[model samples]
Target: MIRITKELSFPLENILFSFALKSEAADVFDGHNTLITGIGKVNAAYELSKAIQHKKPSLIVNLGSAGSNYFQKGDVICCSKFIQRDMDVRGLGFEQYETPLSNLPILLEYGFEMEGLQTGICGTGDNFEMGHNTRIYNVVDMEAYALAMIAMKENIPFLCLKYISDGADDNAADDWMIQVHKAAVAYGNILNLNKNNISI
Candidate 1:
Protein backbone atom coordinates (compact mmCIF):
# COMPACT_ATOMS: atom_id res chain seq x y z
CA MET A 1 0.00 0.00 0.00
CA ILE A 2 1.14 3.59 -0.63
CA ARG A 3 0.31 6.59 1.51
CA ILE A 4 0.55 10.19 0.32
CA THR A 5 0.04 13.06 2.70
CA LYS A 6 -2.04 16.22 2.12
CA GLU A 7 1.11 18.22 1.67
CA LEU A 8 1.22 16.60 -1.75
CA SER A 9 -0.74 19.52 -3.14
CA PHE A 10 1.59 22.24 -1.90
CA PRO A 11 2.81 23.10 -5.37
CA LEU A 12 -0.54 22.95 -7.05
CA GLU A 13 -3.25 25.55 -7.62
CA ASN A 14 -6.23 23.29 -6.97
CA ILE A 15 -5.52 22.92 -3.30
CA LEU A 16 -9.11 22.71 -2.14
CA PHE A 17 -10.01 20.16 -4.78
CA SER A 18 -6.95 18.10 -4.14
CA PHE A 19 -7.61 18.28 -0.43
CA ALA A 20 -11.05 16.86 -1.00
CA LEU A 21 -9.31 13.61 -1.78
CA LYS A 22 -7.80 13.47 1.69
CA SER A 23 -8.24 10.32 3.82
CA GLU A 24 -9.62 8.62 0.71
CA ALA A 25 -7.42 6.37 -1.32
CA ALA A 26 -6.57 7.18 -4.92
CA ASP A 27 -6.68 3.64 -6.24
CA VAL A 28 -3.50 2.74 -8.09
CA PHE A 29 -2.41 -0.69 -9.22
CA ASP A 30 -0.08 -3.11 -7.39
CA GLY A 31 -1.71 -2.51 -4.03
CA HIS A 32 -0.52 1.07 -4.18
CA ASN A 33 -2.61 3.62 -2.31
CA THR A 34 -2.51 7.39 -1.80
CA LEU A 35 -3.90 9.50 1.04
CA ILE A 36 -3.75 13.25 1.61
CA THR A 37 -3.86 15.54 4.66
CA GLY A 38 -5.55 18.91 4.21
CA ILE A 39 -3.62 20.34 7.14
CA GLY A 40 -0.32 22.02 6.16
CA LYS A 41 3.16 22.95 7.52
CA VAL A 42 4.04 21.71 11.00
CA ASN A 43 0.48 20.59 11.19
CA ALA A 44 1.07 18.50 8.09
CA ALA A 45 3.74 16.46 9.82
CA TYR A 46 1.80 16.17 13.05
CA GLU A 47 -1.41 15.16 11.32
CA LEU A 48 0.30 12.84 8.88
CA SER A 49 1.99 11.04 11.73
CA LYS A 50 -1.38 10.35 13.25
CA ALA A 51 -2.72 9.22 9.89
CA ILE A 52 0.18 6.86 9.40
CA GLN A 53 -0.25 5.40 12.85
CA HIS A 54 -3.88 4.79 12.11
CA LYS A 55 -3.35 3.24 8.69
CA LYS A 56 0.17 1.83 9.03
CA PRO A 57 0.51 1.96 5.27
CA SER A 58 3.41 0.36 3.47
CA LEU A 59 5.14 3.43 2.06
CA ILE A 60 5.04 7.19 2.49
CA VAL A 61 5.48 9.42 -0.54
CA ASN A 62 5.84 13.20 -0.23
CA LEU A 63 5.24 14.83 -3.59
CA GLY A 64 5.60 18.59 -3.96
CA SER A 65 7.52 21.56 -5.36
CA ALA A 66 11.06 22.50 -4.47
CA GLY A 67 13.17 25.57 -5.12
CA SER A 68 16.77 25.35 -6.17
CA ASN A 69 19.86 27.49 -5.99
CA TYR A 70 21.73 25.36 -8.50
CA PHE A 71 18.84 23.61 -10.18
CA GLN A 72 17.18 25.14 -13.21
CA LYS A 73 13.43 25.39 -13.48
CA GLY A 74 11.52 22.18 -14.28
CA ASP A 75 14.08 19.84 -12.78
CA VAL A 76 12.75 16.86 -10.83
CA ILE A 77 14.60 15.92 -7.69
CA CYS A 78 14.26 12.62 -5.84
CA CYS A 79 15.63 13.41 -2.40
CA SER A 80 17.92 10.84 -0.77
CA LYS A 81 18.23 12.85 2.42
CA PHE A 82 16.65 15.83 4.18
CA ILE A 83 17.95 18.56 6.54
CA GLN A 84 16.36 21.06 8.87
CA ARG A 85 18.08 24.27 7.84
CA ASP A 86 16.10 26.67 9.96
CA MET A 87 16.05 24.85 13.30
CA ASP A 88 18.70 27.27 14.41
CA VAL A 89 19.05 27.50 18.17
CA ARG A 90 21.84 30.08 18.02
CA GLY A 91 19.38 32.89 17.56
CA LEU A 92 17.43 31.17 20.29
CA GLY A 93 20.85 29.99 21.60
CA PHE A 94 21.80 26.59 20.16
CA GLU A 95 23.80 25.00 17.35
CA GLN A 96 23.62 22.07 14.88
CA TYR A 97 21.19 21.30 12.12
CA GLU A 98 18.72 18.53 12.94
CA THR A 99 18.16 15.65 10.54
CA PRO A 100 14.64 14.36 10.15
CA LEU A 101 13.85 11.07 11.83
CA SER A 102 12.06 8.59 9.52
CA ASN A 103 11.29 5.04 8.56
CA LEU A 104 13.34 5.44 5.37
CA PRO A 105 15.61 2.68 6.57
CA ILE A 106 12.68 0.30 6.68
CA LEU A 107 11.87 1.17 3.08
CA LEU A 108 15.47 0.58 2.09
CA GLU A 109 15.47 -2.65 4.02
CA TYR A 110 12.24 -3.68 2.38
CA GLY A 111 13.71 -3.24 -1.09
CA PHE A 112 12.82 0.36 -1.84
CA GLU A 113 15.86 1.50 -3.74
CA MET A 114 16.70 5.21 -3.84
CA GLU A 115 19.96 5.12 -5.73
CA GLY A 116 21.03 8.30 -7.46
CA LEU A 117 18.47 9.95 -9.61
CA GLN A 118 19.62 13.13 -7.89
CA THR A 119 21.18 12.58 -4.50
CA GLY A 120 21.34 15.76 -2.43
CA ILE A 121 20.33 17.33 0.87
CA CYS A 122 16.89 18.99 0.92
CA GLY A 123 17.07 22.00 3.24
CA THR A 124 13.91 22.78 5.21
CA GLY A 125 12.69 26.06 6.67
CA ASP A 126 9.35 27.33 7.99
CA ASN A 127 9.22 30.09 5.40
CA PHE A 128 9.31 29.85 1.65
CA GLU A 129 12.81 31.10 1.09
CA MET A 130 13.06 30.67 -2.61
CA GLY A 131 12.15 33.99 -4.23
CA HIS A 132 13.02 36.40 -1.46
CA ASN A 133 16.00 34.69 0.17
CA THR A 134 17.37 32.76 -2.78
CA ARG A 135 19.04 30.29 -0.46
CA ILE A 136 21.69 27.97 -1.91
CA TYR A 137 20.29 24.58 -1.10
CA ASN A 138 20.18 21.68 -3.51
CA VAL A 139 16.48 21.58 -2.88
CA VAL A 140 14.38 23.81 -0.61
CA ASP A 141 10.91 23.16 0.69
CA MET A 142 8.68 23.57 3.76
CA GLU A 143 7.45 20.13 4.76
CA ALA A 144 9.52 17.21 3.58
CA TYR A 145 11.95 17.20 6.47
CA ALA A 146 9.23 17.34 9.07
CA LEU A 147 7.34 14.59 7.33
CA ALA A 148 10.47 12.51 7.11
CA MET A 149 11.20 13.06 10.77
CA ILE A 150 7.77 11.90 11.74
CA ALA A 151 7.96 8.81 9.58
CA MET A 152 11.33 8.00 11.05
CA LYS A 153 9.96 8.09 14.56
CA GLU A 154 7.15 5.78 13.54
CA ASN A 155 9.47 3.42 11.70
CA ILE A 156 7.62 3.75 8.40
CA PRO A 157 9.16 4.09 4.99
CA PHE A 158 9.37 7.56 3.44
CA LEU A 159 10.36 9.13 0.13
CA CYS A 160 10.05 12.59 -1.42
CA LEU A 161 9.55 13.43 -5.09
CA LYS A 162 10.01 17.13 -5.87
CA TYR A 163 9.88 19.20 -9.02
CA ILE A 164 11.96 22.34 -9.14
CA SER A 165 9.58 25.24 -9.69
CA ASP A 166 11.90 28.12 -8.91
CA GLY A 167 15.57 28.93 -8.49
CA ALA A 168 15.34 30.18 -4.91
CA ASP A 169 16.16 33.77 -5.76
CA ASP A 170 14.39 37.07 -6.30
CA ASN A 171 12.51 35.52 -9.18
CA ALA A 172 11.84 32.24 -7.44
CA ALA A 173 8.27 32.94 -6.43
CA ASP A 174 7.35 34.29 -9.83
CA ASP A 175 9.12 31.45 -11.57
CA TRP A 176 7.06 28.94 -9.61
CA MET A 177 3.88 30.80 -10.44
CA ILE A 178 4.61 30.42 -14.14
CA GLN A 179 5.47 26.73 -14.04
CA VAL A 180 3.08 25.45 -11.37
CA HIS A 181 0.54 23.92 -13.71
CA LYS A 182 3.18 22.03 -15.59
CA ALA A 183 4.78 20.93 -12.35
CA ALA A 184 1.52 19.60 -10.97
CA VAL A 185 0.74 17.66 -14.12
CA ALA A 186 4.16 16.11 -14.27
CA TYR A 187 4.16 15.18 -10.59
CA GLY A 188 0.67 13.69 -10.65
CA ASN A 189 1.38 11.67 -13.77
CA ILE A 190 4.66 10.42 -12.47
CA LEU A 191 2.99 9.27 -9.26
CA ASN A 192 0.27 7.66 -11.29
CA LEU A 193 2.68 5.82 -13.58
CA ASN A 194 5.31 4.78 -11.08
CA LYS A 195 2.96 2.97 -8.78
CA ASN A 196 5.10 -0.15 -8.66
CA ASN A 197 8.46 0.86 -10.02
CA ILE A 198 10.30 1.48 -6.74
CA SER A 199 13.78 0.85 -8.06
CA ILE A 200 14.73 4.50 -7.83
Candidate 2:
Protein backbone atom coordinates (compact mmCIF):
# COMPACT_ATOMS: atom_id res chain seq x y z
CA MET A 1 0.00 0.00 0.00
CA ILE A 2 2.03 2.95 -1.27
CA ARG A 3 0.81 6.50 -0.90
CA ILE A 4 1.41 8.34 -4.18
CA THR A 5 1.39 11.77 -2.51
CA LYS A 6 4.09 12.52 0.01
CA GLU A 7 2.27 15.37 1.67
CA LEU A 8 -1.41 14.99 2.44
CA SER A 9 -3.33 18.13 1.62
CA PHE A 10 -6.87 19.43 2.04
CA PRO A 11 -9.87 18.11 0.09
CA LEU A 12 -7.94 14.96 -0.87
CA GLU A 13 -6.58 14.18 2.58
CA ASN A 14 -9.61 12.19 3.65
CA ILE A 15 -10.06 10.55 0.27
CA LEU A 16 -8.15 7.40 -0.60
CA PHE A 17 -7.51 6.70 -4.27
CA SER A 18 -7.41 2.94 -4.92
CA PHE A 19 -6.04 1.37 -8.08
CA ALA A 20 -5.54 -2.24 -9.10
CA LEU A 21 -2.25 -1.47 -10.87
CA LYS A 22 0.14 1.48 -10.95
CA SER A 23 -0.01 1.52 -14.72
CA GLU A 24 -3.74 2.16 -14.60
CA ALA A 25 -3.27 5.18 -12.40
CA ALA A 26 0.07 6.33 -13.87
CA ASP A 27 1.31 9.60 -12.28
CA VAL A 28 -1.72 11.76 -12.83
CA PHE A 29 -2.86 11.15 -9.26
CA ASP A 30 0.55 12.00 -7.80
CA GLY A 31 -0.70 14.77 -5.56
CA HIS A 32 -3.41 12.67 -3.99
CA ASN A 33 -3.30 9.81 -1.52
CA THR A 34 -3.22 6.75 -3.75
CA LEU A 35 -3.00 3.03 -2.96
CA ILE A 36 -1.77 0.65 -5.64
CA THR A 37 -3.48 -2.59 -4.58
CA GLY A 38 -1.99 -4.70 -7.39
CA ILE A 39 -4.34 -6.81 -9.57
CA GLY A 40 -7.16 -9.31 -8.95
CA LYS A 41 -9.68 -9.71 -6.12
CA VAL A 42 -7.43 -11.20 -3.46
CA ASN A 43 -4.70 -8.61 -3.74
CA ALA A 44 -7.22 -5.81 -3.82
CA ALA A 45 -9.03 -7.07 -0.73
CA TYR A 46 -5.85 -7.66 1.26
CA GLU A 47 -4.19 -4.35 0.44
CA LEU A 48 -7.32 -2.31 1.04
CA SER A 49 -7.99 -4.08 4.36
CA LYS A 50 -4.45 -3.28 5.49
CA ALA A 51 -4.81 0.33 4.43
CA ILE A 52 -8.08 0.65 6.30
CA GLN A 53 -6.62 -0.85 9.47
CA HIS A 54 -3.65 1.51 9.30
CA LYS A 55 -5.76 4.56 8.58
CA LYS A 56 -9.48 4.58 7.95
CA PRO A 57 -10.42 6.94 5.16
CA SER A 58 -13.66 8.87 4.78
CA LEU A 59 -13.96 7.87 1.16
CA ILE A 60 -12.41 5.13 -0.97
CA VAL A 61 -12.24 6.08 -4.62
CA ASN A 62 -11.37 3.23 -6.96
CA LEU A 63 -9.93 4.31 -10.30
CA GLY A 64 -8.87 1.80 -12.93
CA SER A 65 -9.18 0.56 -16.49
CA ALA A 66 -11.84 -1.98 -17.45
CA GLY A 67 -13.18 -3.96 -20.42
CA SER A 68 -16.74 -3.38 -21.55
CA ASN A 69 -18.95 -4.75 -24.27
CA TYR A 70 -21.64 -2.13 -23.78
CA PHE A 71 -19.49 0.99 -23.46
CA GLN A 72 -17.14 2.40 -26.05
CA LYS A 73 -13.42 2.76 -25.60
CA GLY A 74 -12.12 5.97 -23.98
CA ASP A 75 -15.30 6.40 -21.99
CA VAL A 76 -14.94 7.20 -18.29
CA ILE A 77 -17.71 5.41 -16.41
CA CYS A 78 -18.90 5.82 -12.84
CA CYS A 79 -19.75 2.44 -11.40
CA SER A 80 -22.09 2.62 -8.43
CA LYS A 81 -23.14 -1.01 -8.57
CA PHE A 82 -20.85 -4.04 -8.44
CA ILE A 83 -21.26 -7.81 -8.81
CA GLN A 84 -18.90 -10.76 -8.53
CA ARG A 85 -19.19 -12.27 -11.97
CA ASP A 86 -17.27 -15.44 -11.19
CA MET A 87 -19.17 -16.41 -8.04
CA ASP A 88 -21.33 -19.31 -9.17
CA VAL A 89 -22.55 -21.67 -6.47
CA ARG A 90 -25.92 -22.54 -7.96
CA GLY A 91 -25.48 -26.24 -7.24
CA LEU A 92 -25.65 -25.56 -3.48
CA GLY A 93 -28.98 -23.77 -3.80
CA PHE A 94 -27.25 -20.40 -3.67
CA GLU A 95 -28.02 -17.69 -6.17
CA GLN A 96 -25.53 -16.68 -8.82
CA TYR A 97 -23.04 -14.04 -7.71
CA GLU A 98 -23.97 -14.71 -4.09
CA THR A 99 -21.36 -15.48 -1.49
CA PRO A 100 -22.50 -18.66 0.28
CA LEU A 101 -23.54 -18.06 3.90
CA SER A 102 -22.12 -14.53 3.82
CA ASN A 103 -25.50 -12.75 3.88
CA LEU A 104 -24.21 -10.35 1.23
CA PRO A 105 -26.47 -9.53 -1.66
CA ILE A 106 -25.88 -10.74 -5.21
CA LEU A 107 -25.51 -7.17 -6.38
CA LEU A 108 -23.62 -4.72 -4.19
CA GLU A 109 -24.78 -1.23 -4.95
CA TYR A 110 -22.71 1.21 -2.95
CA GLY A 111 -20.77 4.06 -4.49
CA PHE A 112 -20.97 7.75 -5.22
CA GLU A 113 -22.59 8.55 -8.51
CA MET A 114 -20.59 11.24 -10.23
CA GLU A 115 -22.62 13.81 -12.08
CA GLY A 116 -22.08 14.11 -15.84
CA LEU A 117 -20.51 10.68 -16.05
CA GLN A 118 -22.17 7.61 -17.48
CA THR A 119 -23.18 5.14 -14.78
CA GLY A 120 -22.38 1.44 -15.19
CA ILE A 121 -22.67 -1.87 -13.38
CA CYS A 122 -19.17 -3.31 -12.87
CA GLY A 123 -18.60 -7.07 -12.77
CA THR A 124 -15.41 -8.14 -11.01
CA GLY A 125 -13.74 -11.48 -11.49
CA ASP A 126 -10.33 -13.09 -11.17
CA ASN A 127 -9.96 -13.86 -14.86
CA PHE A 128 -9.66 -11.37 -17.69
CA GLU A 129 -12.85 -11.33 -19.73
CA MET A 130 -12.26 -11.96 -23.42
CA GLY A 131 -15.84 -12.83 -24.31
CA HIS A 132 -18.33 -11.09 -22.05
CA ASN A 133 -21.88 -12.28 -22.75
CA THR A 134 -23.66 -11.28 -19.54
CA ARG A 135 -26.11 -8.41 -19.66
CA ILE A 136 -26.13 -8.07 -15.86
CA TYR A 137 -23.08 -5.85 -15.89
CA ASN A 138 -21.92 -3.53 -18.61
CA VAL A 139 -18.33 -3.26 -17.38
CA VAL A 140 -15.84 -5.92 -16.38
CA ASP A 141 -12.84 -5.51 -14.10
CA MET A 142 -10.59 -7.51 -11.78
CA GLU A 143 -10.86 -5.70 -8.44
CA ALA A 144 -13.70 -3.29 -7.89
CA TYR A 145 -16.06 -5.83 -6.25
CA ALA A 146 -13.66 -6.73 -3.45
CA LEU A 147 -12.72 -3.12 -2.85
CA ALA A 148 -16.36 -2.10 -2.75
CA MET A 149 -17.17 -4.93 -0.35
CA ILE A 150 -14.45 -3.84 2.05
CA ALA A 151 -15.65 -0.27 1.96
CA MET A 152 -19.21 -1.40 2.59
CA LYS A 153 -18.19 -3.49 5.58
CA GLU A 154 -16.18 -0.63 7.07
CA ASN A 155 -18.95 1.91 6.47
CA ILE A 156 -16.72 4.01 4.28
CA PRO A 157 -18.10 5.90 1.32
CA PHE A 158 -17.01 4.42 -1.98
CA LEU A 159 -16.59 5.85 -5.45
CA CYS A 160 -15.61 3.84 -8.52
CA LEU A 161 -14.46 5.31 -11.81
CA LYS A 162 -13.58 3.03 -14.69
CA TYR A 163 -11.95 3.90 -17.99
CA ILE A 164 -13.17 1.70 -20.82
CA SER A 165 -9.94 0.37 -22.32
CA ASP A 166 -11.26 -2.48 -24.41
CA GLY A 167 -14.30 -4.36 -25.61
CA ALA A 168 -14.62 -7.70 -23.86
CA ASP A 169 -14.03 -9.80 -26.96
CA ASP A 170 -11.24 -11.52 -28.92
CA ASN A 171 -9.52 -8.19 -29.57
CA ALA A 172 -9.63 -7.16 -25.89
CA ALA A 173 -6.02 -7.99 -25.03
CA ASP A 174 -4.53 -5.97 -27.86
CA ASP A 175 -6.88 -3.07 -27.36
CA TRP A 176 -6.34 -3.01 -23.59
CA MET A 177 -2.59 -2.78 -24.05
CA ILE A 178 -2.97 0.23 -26.30
CA GLN A 179 -5.70 2.15 -24.43
CA VAL A 180 -4.78 1.44 -20.80
CA HIS A 181 -2.15 4.16 -20.75
CA LYS A 182 -4.76 6.80 -21.40
CA ALA A 183 -6.85 5.89 -18.33
CA ALA A 184 -4.92 8.14 -16.00
CA VAL A 185 -5.45 11.20 -18.18
CA ALA A 186 -9.19 10.63 -18.33
CA TYR A 187 -9.37 10.02 -14.56
CA GLY A 188 -7.27 13.10 -13.90
CA ASN A 189 -9.71 15.25 -15.79
CA ILE A 190 -12.72 13.76 -14.00
CA LEU A 191 -11.23 14.12 -10.54
CA ASN A 192 -10.05 17.66 -11.20
CA LEU A 193 -13.51 18.70 -12.26
CA ASN A 194 -15.21 16.97 -9.32
CA LYS A 195 -12.72 17.60 -6.51
CA ASN A 196 -14.24 20.87 -5.48
CA ASN A 197 -17.81 20.42 -6.55
CA ILE A 198 -18.66 16.92 -5.36
CA SER A 199 -19.21 16.04 -1.72
CA ILE A 200 -17.37 12.76 -1.96
Candidate 3:
Protein backbone atom coordinates (compact mmCIF):
# COMPACT_ATOMS: atom_id res chain seq x y z
CA MET A 1 0.00 0.00 0.00
CA ILE A 2 2.91 2.36 -0.55
CA ARG A 3 3.38 4.25 -3.80
CA ILE A 4 6.69 5.77 -4.87
CA THR A 5 7.80 7.90 -7.85
CA LYS A 6 10.98 9.43 -9.23
CA GLU A 7 11.75 12.09 -11.84
CA LEU A 8 14.80 10.50 -13.48
CA SER A 9 16.15 7.10 -14.32
CA PHE A 10 19.09 7.47 -11.96
CA PRO A 11 16.91 8.19 -8.94
CA LEU A 12 14.35 5.63 -10.08
CA GLU A 13 17.00 3.00 -10.64
CA ASN A 14 18.53 3.58 -7.24
CA ILE A 15 15.13 3.56 -5.63
CA LEU A 16 14.21 0.24 -7.25
CA PHE A 17 17.47 -1.34 -6.17
CA SER A 18 16.84 -0.08 -2.65
CA PHE A 19 13.33 -1.44 -2.66
CA ALA A 20 14.55 -4.83 -3.83
CA LEU A 21 17.09 -5.04 -1.06
CA LYS A 22 14.95 -3.56 1.73
CA SER A 23 11.37 -4.49 1.20
CA GLU A 24 9.59 -7.81 1.01
CA ALA A 25 6.86 -6.08 -1.02
CA ALA A 26 9.14 -5.10 -3.90
CA ASP A 27 7.31 -7.33 -6.34
CA VAL A 28 3.87 -6.06 -5.43
CA PHE A 29 3.59 -3.87 -8.51
CA ASP A 30 5.92 -5.77 -10.85
CA GLY A 31 4.63 -4.16 -14.03
CA HIS A 32 2.31 -1.38 -12.96
CA ASN A 33 4.41 -0.08 -10.08
CA THR A 34 7.17 1.69 -11.91
CA LEU A 35 6.11 4.56 -14.15
CA ILE A 36 8.79 5.99 -16.41
CA THR A 37 8.36 9.73 -16.73
CA GLY A 38 11.15 11.98 -17.94
CA ILE A 39 12.44 14.79 -15.67
CA GLY A 40 10.81 18.19 -15.04
CA LYS A 41 9.18 19.36 -11.81
CA VAL A 42 5.81 20.00 -13.35
CA ASN A 43 5.70 16.91 -15.55
CA ALA A 44 6.63 14.61 -12.69
CA ALA A 45 3.97 16.22 -10.55
CA TYR A 46 1.27 15.71 -13.14
CA GLU A 47 2.25 12.15 -13.90
CA LEU A 48 2.66 11.27 -10.25
CA SER A 49 -0.67 12.80 -9.36
CA LYS A 50 -2.31 10.77 -12.10
CA ALA A 51 -0.56 7.67 -10.89
CA ILE A 52 -1.68 8.36 -7.33
CA GLN A 53 -5.23 8.68 -8.56
CA HIS A 54 -4.88 5.39 -10.35
CA LYS A 55 -3.10 3.52 -7.59
CA LYS A 56 -4.83 5.15 -4.62
CA PRO A 57 -2.11 4.04 -2.25
CA SER A 58 -2.25 4.49 1.50
CA LEU A 59 1.10 6.23 1.47
CA ILE A 60 2.92 8.02 -1.34
CA VAL A 61 6.68 8.48 -1.06
CA ASN A 62 8.76 10.61 -3.41
CA LEU A 63 12.42 9.60 -3.54
CA GLY A 64 15.14 11.68 -5.21
CA SER A 65 18.34 13.72 -4.89
CA ALA A 66 18.61 17.34 -3.80
CA GLY A 67 21.11 20.13 -3.15
CA SER A 68 21.60 21.42 0.36
CA ASN A 69 23.53 24.06 2.25
CA TYR A 70 23.97 22.68 5.76
CA PHE A 71 23.72 19.01 4.89
CA GLN A 72 26.60 16.90 3.74
CA LYS A 73 26.37 14.39 0.92
CA GLY A 74 24.23 11.31 1.75
CA ASP A 75 22.16 13.11 4.37
CA VAL A 76 18.47 12.34 4.23
CA ILE A 77 15.79 15.06 4.38
CA CYS A 78 12.26 14.03 5.25
CA CYS A 79 10.35 17.21 4.54
CA SER A 80 7.55 18.08 6.92
CA LYS A 81 6.30 20.44 4.27
CA PHE A 82 7.30 21.09 0.66
CA ILE A 83 7.01 24.46 -1.10
CA GLN A 84 7.48 25.82 -4.60
CA ARG A 85 9.86 28.69 -3.89
CA ASP A 86 10.08 29.68 -7.55
CA MET A 87 6.42 30.43 -7.99
CA ASP A 88 5.76 34.16 -7.95
CA VAL A 89 2.08 34.59 -7.42
CA ARG A 90 1.99 37.75 -5.34
CA GLY A 91 2.62 40.07 -8.28
CA LEU A 92 0.69 38.01 -10.85
CA GLY A 93 -1.35 36.92 -7.81
CA PHE A 94 -2.29 33.37 -6.73
CA GLU A 95 -0.75 30.50 -4.83
CA GLN A 96 0.69 28.64 -7.79
CA TYR A 97 2.49 25.91 -5.90
CA GLU A 98 0.99 25.39 -2.48
CA THR A 99 1.08 22.11 -0.56
CA PRO A 100 -1.10 21.31 2.41
CA LEU A 101 0.35 21.04 5.88
CA SER A 102 -0.43 17.38 6.56
CA ASN A 103 -0.77 18.22 10.29
CA LEU A 104 2.69 16.75 10.63
CA PRO A 105 5.14 18.25 13.11
CA ILE A 106 8.25 19.98 11.84
CA LEU A 107 11.10 18.57 13.91
CA LEU A 108 13.20 15.41 13.95
CA GLU A 109 11.40 13.16 16.40
CA TYR A 110 13.01 9.91 15.30
CA GLY A 111 16.65 10.90 15.10
CA PHE A 112 17.71 8.11 17.48
CA GLU A 113 16.31 5.59 15.02
CA MET A 114 17.46 7.36 11.83
CA GLU A 115 20.81 9.05 11.91
CA GLY A 116 21.92 12.16 10.03
CA LEU A 117 18.38 13.31 9.39
CA GLN A 118 17.29 16.95 9.17
CA THR A 119 14.03 18.86 8.81
CA GLY A 120 13.58 22.11 6.96
CA ILE A 121 11.68 23.86 4.21
CA CYS A 122 12.42 22.27 0.81
CA GLY A 123 12.35 24.81 -2.00
CA THR A 124 11.34 23.10 -5.23
CA GLY A 125 11.87 24.40 -8.74
CA ASP A 126 11.72 23.25 -12.36
CA ASN A 127 15.49 23.56 -12.61
CA PHE A 128 18.38 22.31 -10.50
CA GLU A 129 19.20 25.29 -8.31
CA MET A 130 22.93 25.81 -7.85
CA GLY A 131 25.65 28.35 -7.09
CA HIS A 132 24.58 31.87 -6.09
CA ASN A 133 21.00 30.82 -6.72
CA THR A 134 21.19 28.68 -3.62
CA ARG A 135 22.01 31.62 -1.36
CA ILE A 136 18.31 32.29 -0.90
CA TYR A 137 17.41 28.77 0.25
CA ASN A 138 18.73 25.82 2.16
CA VAL A 139 17.91 22.94 -0.17
CA VAL A 140 16.82 22.70 -3.81
CA ASP A 141 15.32 20.07 -6.06
CA MET A 142 13.10 19.69 -9.13
CA GLU A 143 9.97 17.94 -7.95
CA ALA A 144 9.13 17.80 -4.25
CA TYR A 145 6.98 20.90 -3.97
CA ALA A 146 4.96 20.18 -7.08
CA LEU A 147 4.42 16.59 -6.03
CA ALA A 148 3.37 17.84 -2.62
CA MET A 149 1.06 20.37 -4.22
CA ILE A 150 -0.68 17.71 -6.28
CA ALA A 151 -0.82 15.28 -3.40
CA MET A 152 -2.45 17.92 -1.24
CA LYS A 153 -5.03 18.63 -3.90
CA GLU A 154 -5.67 14.93 -4.40
CA ASN A 155 -6.07 14.29 -0.68
CA ILE A 156 -3.22 11.83 -0.36
CA PRO A 157 -0.83 11.54 2.57
CA PHE A 158 2.40 12.28 0.76
CA LEU A 159 5.89 12.04 2.17
CA CYS A 160 8.75 13.96 0.54
CA LEU A 161 12.04 12.14 1.17
CA LYS A 162 15.14 13.34 -0.63
CA TYR A 163 18.80 12.51 -0.09
CA ILE A 164 21.41 15.20 -0.31
CA SER A 165 23.59 14.33 -3.25
CA ASP A 166 25.28 17.69 -3.53
CA GLY A 167 25.90 20.99 -1.86
CA ALA A 168 24.30 24.15 -3.20
CA ASP A 169 27.04 25.54 -5.42
CA ASP A 170 28.94 25.15 -8.70
CA ASN A 171 30.30 21.79 -7.57
CA ALA A 172 26.82 20.26 -7.16
CA ALA A 173 26.71 18.09 -10.25
CA ASP A 174 30.08 16.52 -9.59
CA ASP A 175 29.17 15.91 -5.99
CA TRP A 176 25.90 14.24 -6.97
CA MET A 177 27.52 11.72 -9.30
CA ILE A 178 29.99 10.84 -6.60
CA GLN A 179 27.53 10.50 -3.74
CA VAL A 180 24.32 9.22 -5.30
CA HIS A 181 24.89 5.58 -4.43
CA LYS A 182 25.42 6.27 -0.76
CA ALA A 183 22.52 8.70 -0.82
CA ALA A 184 20.30 5.98 -2.26
CA VAL A 185 21.23 3.61 0.51
CA ALA A 186 20.33 6.21 3.11
CA TYR A 187 17.01 6.82 1.37
CA GLY A 188 16.24 3.11 1.46
CA ASN A 189 16.91 3.02 5.17
CA ILE A 190 14.53 5.92 5.71
CA LEU A 191 11.83 4.15 3.72
CA ASN A 192 12.31 0.79 5.37
CA LEU A 193 11.73 2.29 8.78
CA ASN A 194 8.44 3.87 7.70
CA LYS A 195 9.34 7.22 9.18
CA ASN A 196 6.79 9.22 7.23
CA ASN A 197 4.60 9.87 10.23
CA ILE A 198 7.60 10.92 12.30
CA SER A 199 7.44 14.33 10.54
CA ILE A 200 10.37 16.68 10.21
Instruction: Give the per-residue lDDT of model 1 (tens digit) for 143-165.
Output: 77777776667776666767787
Give each model's whole-structure lDDT.
0.55, 0.87, 0.53
lDDT by residue (tens digit), candidate 3, 114-188: 234566567777776666344334677776666666666666555666678898778988987676556444654
Question: How close to the true structure is residue 7 of candidate 2, measured as C-alpha lDDT?
Answer: 43
Superposed by TM-score, candidate 2 places the C-alpha of residue 91 at a distance from the truth, in angstroms, of: 1.7
- Lowest lDDT block of 10, candidate 3: 105-114
Residue pairs that clash (backbone atoms under 3 angstroms), model 1: 2-33, 6-37, 89-93, 89-94, 90-94, 101-149, 101-152, 102-152, 103-152, 134-168
Per-candidate TM vs. native?
0.66, 0.90, 0.64
How would you encode candidate 2's per-residue C-alpha lDDT over 76-189 as one tens digit per residue? 999989999999999999989999989888999997777778999999999999999989999999999999999998998888899999999999999999999999888877
Which candidate wins on lDDT?
2
Stretches off by above 4 angstroms in model 2 are 1-10, 193-200
Q: What TM-score, to 2 decimals, does candidate 2 have?
A: 0.90
Models sorted by lDDT, best on top: 2, 1, 3
